[model samples]
Target: MTGTSPKHDVFHAIADPTRRRLLHLLVDREMPVTVISSHFPMSRTAVSKHLRILSDAGLVKERKVGRETRYRLEPEPLLELKRWLAFYDRFWDNRLSVLKHLVEADDANEPETAVKPIKPQAMDPLSLD
Candidate 1:
């Protein structure tokens, strides 16, 4: 009910590929629904629905220019997504570092040996013996 919070979060809004593509399209510039729909294979109503979801998530802003409505990327909500991903990035980095250390330690403890290749015995293609 409060205007401070969005009806949908950034994650839910971007879950659909169509909505994600809409964000990419609106990133550089604002475009009306008709112009935006032209880039997609669906009807204008479908694009409008995606835009509505993005608007509810605060990922895009809509402006009224004369008779047409234009949409553009807001970008601020994406900071939450970036922060969430960053935590996982650091987590994986630490895990990889530990794994690397373990592998190197194991390698250092192994005895070095010359590897010899085994040769196959000659056999006829039709022989079952």
Candidate 2:
């Protein structure tokens, strides 16, 4: 839902869970339509449609070698997502660092105590009011 750009369209295209899975499958291995469909319970046509969406998004690329159309993942679009995520990653790291310092200081102020068995004190319900 960001501004339209080449990479923005690519991110939108791969936003779907199914499409993302397809990209992951194609990451290291180039797979055919039938091979990709077998990993999913959906029909071959449905898989093909998802592949088409990924292809349109530039998250994946397809090539026809003889009878089978092979699909491969394109990582260039993902770099954008990683870059966006990196900012948040650094932000959280700094926040956690401050928290760690506060927690260490707190632990320094408190000494560990031996556990003592507790006897339950009976409270009269009449006194609760």
Candidate 3:
């Protein structure tokens, strides 16, 4: 019916390298906006704009301390990224295990000299079952 939408604001926000860097600066501890902006050559306004994007993504929290605003990274979305990565990791593990088992099986049944280089069969959809 409709295009898939992300559950929250986190994914697209961290997609940019600048925003990721901003998050890295805040990961260690809360830092004021000026301190964060000083790390880059961009204008203070640019840093503020990046912070707004990060705030909308939920990857960072912004709070005012008297006269200055402080930013800190919120790592829950990073955990979600790790979980998504793990599924692909398991998929690769299973495929590699199957290939290893097949190679072992071939080695057991055939003489070392008799076994030639194994070529993977390209499956043609029209000819495949």
Alpha-carbon TM-score of each model against the true structure: 0.76, 0.77, 0.65
- List residue ranges in candidate 3 displaced over 4 A: 1-8, 95-129
What's the number of clashes in each of the models? 0, 0, 0
Best by TM-score: 2
lDDT per model, in order?
0.95, 0.83, 0.84
Which pairs, if any, clash in model 1? none
State how far residue 34 of model 1 sits from its true place (Å). 1.0
* Residue 3's lDDT in candidate 1: 79
TM-score of 2: 0.77
Query: Of the pair 2 and 3, which is ahead by TM-score?
Result: 2
What does candidate 2's lDDT look like per residue over 40-117, in tens digits?
Answer: 999999999888877666778889999999999888878878888888998899999999999999988887986589
Ranking by TM-score: 2, 1, 3
In the range 67-109, model 3's lDDT, one tens digit per residue, is 9999999888678778888889988999999999999998788
Better of 1 and 2 by lDDT: 1
lDDT of 3: 0.84
